[model samples]
Target: MSIEVNNESGYAVDEAEFAALARHVLDAMHVHPQTDLAIMLVGTDVMSELHVQWMDEPGPTDVLSFPMDELRPGRPGDVTPAGLLGDVVLCPEVAARQARDAGHSTAEELLLLTTHGILHLLGYDHAEPEEEKEMFALQRQLLLTFLATR
Candidate 1:
């Protein structure tokens, strides 16, 4: 997979760990090895612009996903096609604040956001209560599995 993590946020985020997480998640999800993905870490200013432009929201959020080819996970035994998975934009500044609120480290907060972003890229959403449960459960499971190997 062509998973690339770019830390343009100017923070000293661990890029390699994120790349590895992406690889692990995509692989477990059965995404093709030729698939392309980009993870972008940006400051609050850039994230706020994206939030307004894409979501019409007021300020920077934790994460945002912009899917390219609209790739979806294939059924078991089915061959997943290869394509561009798209971008997951993250804000470490917001994550740090959320971390404080959650009583966790900034790194853990970012991992959760990144996992959430990946699920969104794979056509997951939490607009409804049921959807929220399923999406969040899957996100938590994926994160736990990824962390276990670290």
Candidate 2:
């Protein structure tokens, strides 16, 4: 698997840890070894621009996922072909604020968001109540397990 992280947000963050987290998430999800993923950290201004351009939202959000090839997890007996998993853009400044509210470290918040983005890339969504429950539950489980083995 290819997991690349680029931090241009001007905020110092643990880029290696996120790369490891992405690897862990992809390993758990059983993504193909040839799969590729990009995690970019941008400032709030760029994130806001992306939010408006892609999502038509107002301001910068926590995280956004852009999927390529729409690669879903393969069935138990099927093999998943190699493909680009797309990019997950994040804003560390926004995450820090959310971290304060959630009473966790910034790294922890980023980990949660990273998992959330990976799920989205894997074709998981939370547009409905049931979907929200399922997506959030899986996100929580993945984060907990990943952190435990740290």
Best-fitting candidate, measured by lDDT? 1
User: Cα RMSDs of all predictions?
Assistant: 0.9, 1.2
What C-alpha lDDT values do all the predictions have? Answer: 0.92, 0.91
lDDT tens digits, residue span 1-150, model 1: 898999999888888999999988888788888999999999999999999999999899999999999998766566369999999999999999999999999999999999899989999999999999999999999999999999
Clashing pairs in 1: none
- List TM-score per model, in order: 0.97, 0.95
Which stretches of candidate 1 lie above 4 Å from their native place?
A: none
Candidate 2 local lDDT, 30-100, one digit each (tens): 77878999999999999999999999998999999999978887654563689999999999999999999
Question: Residue 134 CA error for candidate 1 (Å)?
Answer: 0.6
RMSD of 2: 1.2
Worst 10 residues of 2 by lDDT: 71-80
* Candidate 2 pairs with clashing backbones: none
